[model samples]
Target: MTDFETLGAFYLGKRYDMPSRARRDDYVLYDAKDLTTHAVIIGMTGSGKTGLGVGLLEEALIDKVPVIAVDPKGDLGNLALRFPALGASDFRPWVDPQQATNAGMTADQFAAQQADLWKNGLAGWGQDGARIQRYHDAADITIYTPGSTAGRPLSLLKAFDAPPAAVRDDAEALQERVNATTTSLLALLGIDADPISSREHILVANLLHHAWREGRSLDLAGLIGGIQSPPFTTVGVMPLDTVFPPKDRMTLAMQLNNLLAAPGFQTWMQGEPLDTATLLYDPNGKPRGSVISIAHLNDAERMFFMTLLLSDILAWVRTQPGTGSLRAILYIDELFGYMPPVTNPPSKVLLLTLLKQARAFGLGVVLATQNPVDLDYRGLSNTGTWFIGRLQTERDKMRVMEGLEGVSGGQPFDKGAMEQTIAGLGKRVFLLHSVHEPAPITFETRWTLSYLAGPMTREQIRSVTALAPAPAPTAALASAPALSTAATGGGFASLDARAAVAPVLPPDVPQYFLPPTRDGALLYNPVVLGLADVSFANAKLGVTEQRRVILMSSVDDGPIALEWDAAERVELEPSALEQRPHDGAAFGALPPVATKARNY
Candidate 1:
């Protein structure tokens, strides 16, 4: 028998006897490794589904197993609400003041009551503040909101980044990613395109496949340009223009461009890049439970982001060495439309792929849903465990039984007994069925360490993540070779005295000198330059503007590189940059800070 106290075994709950209506002393210890085959949770709204899911995540984090949770309903943000103190003060800030008024009690009194209730509930389940503290110490928890800044905003800018070598080398995997990415992008533009029939889909997929094959990356602008004039003359047997005419391609490009130019769409490109490695682990290599809250995004935006994320995750998984033990968990709070029966959305392809191949990489996927009928039973065949909670209708019960039987693999499945067990399930009770166990176990869910404050509002999320680190800075010259006077023991005296030739820079350092707007002898003074094109717009206020600023700063011998605070912003167009300096330019002496490309 597995010990419930072991790190690899998750202490879900004690076994329950439906006939006696009593809980047994023998605790149900679920081996974490069994999750390699994946799991599913199905129940009604009031059947404690969220509580069970949250508890499962809490256990995974406590065991130092990293988790990436996709939360469409916003409840997963509660993972950050764990309070080891379990005091009234710990619960006060999250309690609804209106609830206190409804109960004819003061806010403080309500908080105190809630705290006492949690304490008693945990004690009843053989848990306390000590276990909560252990969970807090085990992993770092963060809530990432994709299209909102209330929580940590996730940027999709890296979505167009080139795939790793492993994925690029595998033709099937490469094409799968290309297809999903193209389909998702089109879907975001309100276009439901068929991969084979739609000219728009074929053009985009060809562009992506061509670029990714050569290890080249394409931003939205580059992709738009490619759509106008493709790099390849032929997409297949026919010429590119014959397959997708210029005018038609331009129409597709304009729709995507409009979405890119939307005032609200900028938020999608702002914050941390959607990197699976960063989401699963912190910079220090510690496990982290990253809750991606996408409740704020629209259906199209959600599908786009989810498809890109899953594609990135699949790519990342391919790069990792194979492992048998569970290395990480990918939990989706809702698996409704993303993996439906008949429809083949962009997300469905990646989900099915993960379900089939991710086990070898030790990536366990756990999907939960209230609407079991919306799910595809073919995908469920890969799942090894099922947590069946209370259902509201007999039809739902029948569907769940059918799914269970389909994945049973010739095991003796008694449908009547299973249906009877599921019908008897009450609130907070679940029937645990796993291929690793000979018999399905009926168990009650334990108390969750997080307070179920319901779906959090934007303001609430902001309050929760107020102390997160600021966004990273944008520095272009950081990759340039460092040139310092300290190393050379002299300034650019030769160039300063000659005043006729440009100073020689390393071949790796890219130089783009602006064309002289005014008629004069050009004096090419060495200064670190930074440029940014910013767009400001508000539909409600009817304001829209685009501005470009060029900031130049003289480098010094100080420890810090170019001080942007002291930089001068000049009105200049970045488009006028030339490959070489003016012919008759006089070179100025470069500073120590200007020697390195990183200073810019």
Candidate 2:
């Protein structure tokens, strides 16, 4: 039996004895680290799968672990709404007036009753106000809408950079990039990727490969241009003209160009590039909880963003140092079409890749689906944990049983008893199965610290994300002087001068500070440089301790702290900073304060 005192073990709920109206305080605890091998949560509609997912996320937040939850149904955005005071006023907006009247109470009364219920229930589970407050303080939640402006909008237009070091060769990396980009573009164009024999696929893939080899990054516009005019005369020894013909290539490119110029599609081009470093960690180097809601997007748009996001995450994973313990989680709430049994959606390939390899890098993937009958269990054999809730159909139950058996790895499964337990499960109840446990157990899910608000509107999402705190500067650069002084000579002047006089940096060098903004603010943009530059600059400036540095972005409403690798690089626009008066301080005369960097 797993020890309850182990780290990451949290109270999930008490065990449920069937056919009894009474309940015992046989508390059931789950070890969060067990999720390193991946987990599955299955149930029918109204079966509390969402509640179970929210509970697990709450546990992760309490443990200070980072999470990236893909919420296709928009319900997970509730992770942002916390009732720290446990007041009814916080619950009133979500309560239905008619439902309250039917229940013989006013809306306010019903809301108060619901609040009390949650409070008492949480108290029973040992999660009182103080403990819940700790969870709130530890978690920094952001709700992102990919194709909507309600939350932080995402731009899927970043350059397809070099592959991770794990990739064997440039040729192999190019092929992977070509495959991913082609699939995404095809999805955008409402076509399927058939790189083997399709003329359009052949033309686009070669164009991407040519641009990549030439160290040229192509956005949507550039891609159209490349297609209109072939970068190379030949494609795989056959003349490009003979294979795709100029007119055919223009026709294909124009189709994509029209899609790009569409008003509804413009949202895809706005906002910062999706950076996993920023998604997973805060400026203070703490783990963050990020909820990406794609419920409002169309099917094609969702697929496009999902493919790119997964590919980016895989690249990020490859950059990390290997670890045996759980480092982060990637949760997909509705895995209906992404990992269906027979259909080969682009996301399925990436999902399977993560399922098989992400564990080695300490990335746990939790997939939840109400439609269990359609899931491809063979691809999910790597999942070791299963949380089974009530299923509506016998077919779904049988499918879940078969999936359980497949993943059991020879462990004995009591199908008949398991079916009975599942069928009898009530709301907020589920069966917990794990290889780490001796046997599967049934338990109720604990109350979530976040209010279970229904799906939020774009305006509501925007309001929540707007209140998020700015990213903090990394510890190494924490005490660095303000961007203005740091760049000119208060401390880093010599280093800046040296860089200016040095030969042009190679494209492979990941760090380079941008020119001073028009307002004269020296923005330490992480998008332009790597962490090593910050470290090198800190050492050159002879700073020893951590200090905070503010990073200003024209695209954001306010300045954010330099969040290490998570900061998105945007085109430096002419700012009011350039119109400000310049200080006449010259080289070789360092201020006394520069010698001692002050901590923020």
Candidate 3:
């Protein structure tokens, strides 16, 4: 027999004897560390898939592992409802009077009886109030609503900003950023992000790449400006006018600008910036349970947020030092179109990348879905554990079996036995097949510490998140240096002032140069001007210099610090040197100049 105690296992319910129709004394256990290979939970709507997910999360919390749960249906908010001292009073609000009457008891009586049942059930599973309290103490929970203010809203407006310290010199990294940003923006605009076919996507990608190389981070407004007056006059061998005419560029910018100015879309611009470090841990160094609820969002909103979030997580994972221990877990409650078999969405690509690479970084992804047929088995093969609950249809069962067989890795699979086990599963019962185990085991899920209150209302969600303390600033933010432009001897002259007295530009010179405004101000760098204002404003806003610098950390820190133009030095405080849009020059104008600047 395997010694679960030594393996740091989570105790599920006892094994079920199919022939005897009874649960055996042998407790089924899942290895906490084995989760590095990832897992999947599959079942029909009423088959208790959510219960199993809650149970898994509870166990992970108990083990002090951080969790990022994507809740599309909003049921996962129940995690905030802790019932350490379960009593009639604790259950009365959740119990229905008519249901109690049907059960031949008053509501209070029924509540009392249910409380006893839960107490005994937890005791049977070797969990007590002390243990449950410990789990709560170890983990902090926050519910995030991406496009709603009901809970903590997530700002996706600056989601496409360049990451701190990512090497711009790396072609692969640059292309990935461009592709992700372009695709995400297109998805937000309700447009398909086919890089090769969509002219809008291509133009956006070109502009993004150009801006990134210039060391500028564009918010929604900045992105719109870039599209309209692109920094580069030529994209490849063709002129910018020939590739995407000024009229077309303005139209594209207007579409995005409209989205930015929309009232409903403003929710995407509020709240804290999504940082993986804060999502995974709190200020006190305790693990956190972050529930990002997208239940109210439409398909386009969900796609946009999910794509950027996953990309951010991937970037963060690359920075972590691999420990080989389970550092974090990502649980997406519904994985339908995000990992479809036939089509590749931006979210799907990032998800697949995580599935393949996150294990090395100690990040485990758990995907649960009612619709198993929609998933890509090839991508799912990367997952090592499968929790198969009851299926409503034969097709779903068959699809799950195929997925199982694919991941079995040539090991003998007893398909008939698996089919029987899956079919015979009762409510809250599941068949757990793990690559770490020699065979599959059937077990009922344990009682959850959090009450299963169904889907929470907006008010309930807000209350839960409000009670939770805000997460500490991310490590990246804490460690990043405040960015400032090198101070010139003249105490920071405005770009306009510098451009006015600058030498006249040659006719053949392409407009749009990178950082450092010279005497003629003819050579303008949007990156230098924008960043200087950003840094100064951030300093005045009480945001730490480090945090402000971290905002622009996506650029390779070394080159940025060493190569910054002295003439465009950043002022810590607001000064006359601050470039203001003078004479209707779009803030931080890029003058046409022929120099060693790289052209997109």
Candidate 4:
């Protein structure tokens, strides 16, 4: 067994360790105590934050700690393959190791051998059942729309009605921290959990009171039924007009329709919340660990929806103390979405409470963002440890420098071997800092490529994420006679039933992988690049699910502005407006992924 019980140094060039590239003395190790602190990892695009993060997770999992990951890009799916690759009986025969390690291997041998790491023993999901199941279980769905008047849904706690499982001892305080979460959520939704003016409170309180009166042993479905109320009488009863500004609700309606079409989601959410081990449904058998993929999500609505689910999970984990004997870790790949004070911030105040207190409750928050500027400073101040990566801006650098000292109590720490902005910008090396480690060190991230290559191309996405074109609703099912949704005594399922959607890509639906065919073709797709989950508003899936619109280039344009309809499609583009004066000032370079098509 490994000597350290918690996080420590990575295998570091130990796999590729060589005096030829740099001296072994240059290596820095991560501190175990930092596991108790908050960590912030920053780096410019492509600076290897993924590699570093995979390394940390691999170590933690090996030590038997369960981790929950928010993999916006699905990059961390490979953490399950960290089984000491170069040992005497392993696959190191392919990896060339200078004259010393190369005696037994070749480059081709290495390439072919590494591919096997992608298997999960089943089929596509890597790492057999252990890693894949962990992710599948943690995956969930959430959907929120901009200017949406629907208000937040009933929280799991309110839906269930049972008082928190009593804390057994002071040592159990960390696990029992769920007691304080309702307040945190209240702060996030800007609703008064107090049952006063927030309007949703009475309903919420009623939902909770119902859970208590109904009985504590009931499952989630029973709880969903207990609080089920008529849509008009429920908070949903508020007139659509009073909730949204105008026709924006139409867009919200359309977006929900899209999610209703995806079969993976249909099969995923069909019955129980516990069957799938999902982030939202949890339908699968509950595994002790999970990883949610948010790569497909790219819009504000989806991003925020995902944030809500994560916050909800933090609350859910509180209810189950013995789900497993090991400590649980929540490693958010790109923490900005959850922690950022951006245009639409989730309950930052409530999230902060979790950040500061959850560690004690067995929830470790790992915030990794390339842009530190977006993180809500008030909440971030709660973090105790930080993984400082290669930052682009001097302001970011300074804020990090100062924040480190403050969090560490001016404890005379080193910013690692590559602390100063200098030559040691290796992909693996990062300026690591923590409250317990006397000095920060420049450490390399673990190389997890044998397992990380997951996202298929656009064609793959279209087929994988797409459904088999759901069959048309029969007269009865279409009327949802069971819901009698419009019926006077309609059930809550009927209320949600009326709003169900069927995905049908319109003629104008754009392709995400297309590029500008003609030069000077500018397509501005309002994309939300995150290291977190993006979800359908009122739908399922988080983490790797993204909300984004791929708008093509405008042939005719003055100075143009972009507007997103509620459905998250590009409702307004430069060409859609009359030409204004054109004075090319300056703009940032576009991400390489954008493709454009000419309009006739």
Best by TM-score: 1
lDDT of 3 by residue, 503-525 (tens): 22222222232333332212222
Weakest lDDT window of 10 consecutive positions for candidate 2: 498-507
| Number of the candidate with higher lDDT, 2 or 4 | 2
Among the numbered candidates, top lDDT falls to: 1
Ranking by lDDT: 1, 3, 2, 4
The digit string of per-residue lDDT tens for model 4 on 1-600 reads 232222344232222232244424333445443564456677766777887776566555544445566666655544433332322233343233453336465655554455453332223211243533433333221221112212111222122234333322232332223223333333433333453353333443334343433334222222222223212333456753454322342343233334434453343233212211242222233233344555554544334335445445545545545321224466777766565655434345446656766665555667788877777665667776676666777777766666665676645555552345323455655655566556555554544423444432333323322322222233323553221111111112213222221111222323122222233412222232112234654434433445544332322122332222211223333333311111111112232222232222
lDDT scores in order = 0.83, 0.72, 0.73, 0.41
Which candidate model has the greater lDDT, 1 or 4?
A: 1
Q: Tell me how many clashing residue pairs each candidate has.
A: 2, 9, 13, 55
Worst 10 residues of 3 by lDDT: 548-557
TM match of model 4 to true structure:
0.49
Write candidate 1's Cα lDDT for 61-138 as tens digits. 999999999999989989988888899999998899999999999999999999999999988888889989999888
Candidate 2 ranges with C-alpha deviation above 4 Å: 1-6, 19-22, 93-107, 168-174, 212-216, 470-600
- Candidate 1: regions farther than 4 A off: 1-3, 468-600
Per-residue lDDT of model 2, residues 310-421, tens digit only: 8788778877888888889899999988888998877888888788888888898999999997799999898989999888888998898888888878878888887888
